[model samples]
Target: MLIYAHRGASADFPELTMAAYEGAVEQGADGFECDLRITKDEVPILWHNASMLERAGNRGLIAEMTYKEVSRAYPQVLTLDTFLDYAIANKKGVLLETKHPVFSGNRVEELLVTALHEKKALAKIAVSVMSFSWLAVEKMRRLDSTINTTFLMHKNTPWFQARFSSSAAIGPGMNELRAEPMIAKKIQSLGRSLNVWTVDKDADIHLCQKLGVDILITNKPAHAREVLGYP
Candidate 1:
C-alpha cells in the first residue's frame, strides 16, 4: 500500500504548511494529502477549517479573506499553486480534498479542476480528488470525468452511498474500518481501492496492510514506514 502524508507529516509540523510537506518528503512519503479552500479572490489555498481562528489565531473566515490578508495573518500558510509546484518539482503524487458547504459553493471544484489542468498534473504525477460530499464528487466528475476521485466515508456515511459512488476509491476513517473490517472486503469486491485516513497507531497500520488497503493516509509517514517495514 502507498503511504501518503496526511496534511504533510502533520504530526511533526504544522498542518498544511510548507514545513510539514517538506518533512513528508524527507520522511519518504509516496504522496502528499491536503485540504483545499479558496480565498475571496478565488485563489486556491491549503487549509482545513472554515475559520482561521485556530490556525491563524484570527477570526477571519477563509472565504472572506484575500490571499494577502491570509498571508499577513499566517505567513506560513501554503497555497495550492505553491504546493503543486513543490510536488511537481519532487515528482511526488498529490491527493487533494476539497472542503464542501463553503461560502463559495462549488467554486472550489471549478478552481481545482482549472488548476490541475493548467498544471497538467495528471500527465506528470498521480493526482486524486477526495471529498466527504457526494455532490461535490459528482460535480467534480461533471467538471472533469478524467480526474480520479475518492469518496470519503465517516462512521455515519451511508453504506449504500458508497456502493453507488462513481469514485475510483473509497476513503474510510481508520476507526470505521476497525469497527467493521468487512468494509475493506466490500469495497474491494466492487473493484474500488480502499484508502484509509489518519491512521497513526502501529496496530492500525499493520491492520491496513493486512487488509490490503491501497493507500494509507497518516500524520506520521516515517512512523508508518517503520511500522510497515517499508524501508
Candidate 2:
C-alpha cells in the first residue's frame, strides 16, 4: 500500500502547514493529504477546523476571514494554491478532503474543481477529492467525474453508504477497520478501493498490508516505510 502523509507528517510538524508538507517530502511519503476550507473571499485554504482556535490560537471563524486576515493571524498558514504548487513541484500525489457543513455550502467543491481544472493537476499527479458528507462526494462527481472521489466513513457513517456512493474509493478510519475486518472485503466486493486513515500502529499497518489496502494514510510516513521494509 502507498503511504500518504496525513495532514503532511502531522506528528512531526503542524498540520496543514507548509512545514508539515515539507517534512512529509523529506520523510519519503508517496503522497500528501490535507483538509480544505474556503475563506470569506472565496480563496481555498488548507485548514481542518471551522474556527482557528485550535491551530492558530484565534477564535475567529475561518470562513469570516480573508486570506490576508488569516495570514496575519497565523503566518504559517498554507493556501490550497500554495500547497498544490508544492505538491506539483515535488511530484507528490494529493488526497484533498473537503470539510463539509460549512457556511459556504458546496462552494468548496466548486472552487476545488476549478483549481484542479486550471492547474491540469490530473495530468501531472494522482488527485482524489474525499469527504465525509455523501452529498459533497456526489457534488464533486457532478462537478467533475474525471477526478476521483472517496467517501470517508467514520463511526457514525452507515456501511451501505459506500455501496451507493459515486466515489471511486471508500475511506474508513483505522479503528473502524480493526473492529470490522470484513469491511475491507466488503469494500472490495463493491469494486471500490480502500483508503484507510491515520494508520499509525505497526499492527494497523500490517493489517492494511494483509487486507490489500490501496492507500495507507498516516502521520508518520518514515516510520511506516520502515515498518513496511521500504528503502
Candidate 3:
C-alpha cells in the first residue's frame, strides 16, 4: 500500500501550492495527486476546478486568461510544466487527473508524456484517467497501454466491471468505502488495486489503512502517515 498526497498535502498549505507539494515529499509521500485543466489559450495548468477564480485573491479567472495572462493574474499559480518540474526535482510521483473530458480526448496524454520525457520524469509517475467519460481513459490507453490508469467511482456495479478490466486499479470515493466494503473486496479480488480518495480525518486514515487500500489519497498525508506508521 502507498500514501498519495491529495492535492499535494493540501491541508497544511494552499491546495496545489508548490510549498504544499514540497512538504509532501519531505513527509515521505509515495505520490501526489494533481488536477489538470486548460487555460483560455489551451495551455494546461495545474488546477482542480473549472476555474481558479475562487482561490485567487483579488485576481481573475485562470481559464479566461492566456498562459501569460494567467501568470500575471496569479503569479503563484503553477503551470503543469512548472509543477512537474518541481515534482521531478524532488522525485515525487504524480497522479495527474484529467478534469476536462471534451478537450482531453488525446492531447492531454500527448502533452504530459512529452513534457515528462523532456524533463526526464516519465518513469517517476503515473497519469490517471479520472474523467467521467470512459473515452478519456480509452484515449490514454491508446496513447500508452503501459501507463497506469484508474477509474474513479462511488460504487462497484456491472457498468464499472465492464470497464474495470481495462484499468490498472479503481479509486473508490471516500464516502462509499465503508458502505461498499463488499464492492471494495470484489475490486481487490479482481487483481486490481484499491485506492480511497479525499480522506482527511485521522479516523478515516486509520480506517483506510485497515481496509488495506493500495493508496490513501488524503489532504493531510503527513498526519495520515503518522496515524498509519507509513514511514
- For every model shown, what is its TM-score relative to the native structure? 0.99, 0.99, 0.87
- Candidate 2 per-residue lDDT over residues 144-226, each given as its tens digit: 88999999999999887888999999999999999999999999999999999989999999999999999999999999999
Model 3 per-residue lDDT tens digits across residues 126-172: 54545444566666777778777777775543455434547777777
Q: Which residue pairs in candidate 1 have backbone atoms (N, alpha carbon, C) closer than 3 angstroms, thus clashing?
A: none
Ranking by lDDT: 2, 1, 3
Clashes (N, CA, C under 3 Å) per candidate: 0, 0, 0
The clash tally of candidate 3 reads: 0
RMSD, every candidate, angstroms = 0.7, 0.6, 2.5
Could you tell me how far off, in angstroms, the CA of residue 81 lies in candidate 3 after the best superposition?
1.4
lDDT of candidate 1 over 63-110, digit per residue (tens) = 999999999999999989999999999998999999988988899999
Which residue runs does candidate 3 get wrong by more than 4 Å?
57-63, 102-106, 125-129, 155-158, 161-165
How far off is model 2, as Cα RMSD?
0.6
